[model samples]
Every structure is written in C-alpha cells, then in structure tokens.
Target: MSWSITLTVNGEPRRVELDDPRVTLLDLLRERLDLTGSKKGCDRGQCGACTVLLDGRRVNSCLALAISHDGAEVVTIEGLARDGALHPVQAAFIEHDAFQCGYCTPGQIMSAVGLIGEGQAGDDPERVREGMSGNLCRCAAYKGITEAVLEAQRRMGQDGWEEAA
Candidate 1:
C-alpha cells in the first residue's frame, strides 16, 4: 500500500509518496528526493555508506524505513553546506584529504557530523576513530578521516552546525 510522509529534509519540508512501506530512507533520498550524496555501497547496514542524520542522530539510511521516520528532520551531505560555505567537517575533510575515491566521503562527513553532535567526537584521535569505525573507507584513509574529524571538532562547536540537528 502506498503511503505519504512529510519530512523536513535539509531544513526544507519534503512530502514524498511511497508505493512501498518497506522502501528505505536511502532509496527515498536518492530516488525520490534526488539526494544521492548518501551512497549505496552496501545495501545492508554493515556499510556506513548510507549514513545520515535523522532527528539529530546518525543512522544507516539503508536500514531506516522511510515510514518509520515520518516527520523526522533528515540531513544529508548535500544539506551540510549553506550559502556557498562548507561545513567545518567538510572543510576539514578537504584539508585532511580524508577521502580518496570519494565514494564514502558523504557518509563519512555525515557520520562525523553526527559524532560531533553526540558529543563523542573529541580531540582524542582514538575516540574519533572508534566513533567513526562504522564508516569504512576502502582507500584506507583512516588517518585522514580521523584527523579531519578531530580538526572539525576542535574548530567548531556543536552549536556551529544547524544541519547536524
């Protein structure tokens, strides 16, 4: 049965019609809403490539049913930047060269954003590593990713981000 859900995506209200309740948020964002930043690396939750912020929390979008998150505020990597300025996490990623293939960058950025919001991504490299363990980078860019998250955390406070909410 088809259903409709009104979600706040990237601070904008989005109303989507779903033909299947089983449809995932990843598909909804990529197919329906055209927010393809969240990749489809592993459709299963094992890969954090489909990570996104849902109601200020990080979740594997591939495993999240769109209907289950109706009315939730969703934030994708595309939504992170505003007014032509990159989010701190984004800028830090660029500075640290956190991505090689760029396939997992979006999820990494989103997960880093969520990690910061949850007050878990600290200046400690090990802490950031543990927090971001879910996002796997085949390029083995863990050093860059860890540095980026740490730098972002040091440079910006949780309040500096609106999309992370």
Candidate 2:
C-alpha cells in the first residue's frame, strides 16, 4: 500500500509517497527528499547524529517513522540558513570549531537549536553540557561544542530567533 505524507520541510511544503510504512524519517529525508545533513550514526536513537526538530522539539529521526508524522513540521540542518547568513547555531559552530570530522555536526547543531528553543541552553556551561549530552562528539570536540551552544544561545536570543512551533 502507498501512503502520502505531507510535511513542511525547511519552510517548504513537501509531499512524499511512501510504499513502506517502516520508512524512517531519516530515510525520508536522506533517501527521498535528498536532505542529507542529518547523519545516520547508530540509527538506534542512542546517538544524536540524526537529530531534527519535529514541531520545534528535538527527535531522533532515524527512529521516527515517516508515516507517523503526516502533517508535521520538520526542520533539518539544511533549513537552518537564510539567504547566505547562517543560523546563530551554525555560525557558533563554525566560530568555535565545534566539529572535527563533521559527520555529527549537523545533528549537534539541530539539537542545540532545539535546546535553545526549549530554554535548556542557559549561560552555564554545565547546564549546556547536561542539555547536550544526547549528542556525542566522537572527535572529542565537547569543549568547542559547549562553547558554541553558549554563544549561539545568546546570539539567537538577541537576534529574536523564532520559528513555527
């Protein structure tokens, strides 16, 4: 059986036909939509490498069934920029050198965006670390990641970062 799922991806409306209900949101994005920023690490929800925002909440896309979110708003790393200016989180990651191998950066940044939106990323480093624990940096870039999140939190607030929830 084929089912159609409509999603608002990166502020654009997308309609996808799914032949399999088991197709995950990750595959829907990477395989169908061609938005490959979200990594496929672990694919077990244990790693935050496939993190994305669903209705403004962070989720492990690899574990989420695409058919289950028929009309959801999904935000991936590819949607975080506008015109040429990067999102605050993206800018922060670049500025702080928060990534080394770059495989997990997208998910980390998305998680950071969600963290900021959820008001979990405060001025405290420990708080930010605790909040971002779900995202693991195999390159041992935690210091820069923590610092980037802090910088982005302040920047997003100052820039009035608001998106469809």
Q: Report, for all candidates in order, the number of backbone clashes.
A: 0, 0
Q: What is the lDDT of residue 89 in candidate 2?
A: 88
For model 2, residues 83-164, the per-residue Cα lDDT tens digits are 8878888989999999999999999999998888888557999999999999988999999999999998887778788753
Q: Name the regions of candidate 2 deviating beyond 4 angstroms.
A: none
How high is the CA lDDT of each candidate model? 0.90, 0.92
Q: List the residue pairs that clash in candidate 2.
A: none
List TM-scores for all candidates, in order: 0.95, 0.96
**Candidate 1 weakest ten by summed lDDT:** 156-165
Per-residue C-alpha lDDT of model 1 across residues 88-136, encoded as one tens digit per residue: 9999999999999999999999999989888864678888899998999
Residue 124, model 2: lDDT of 90
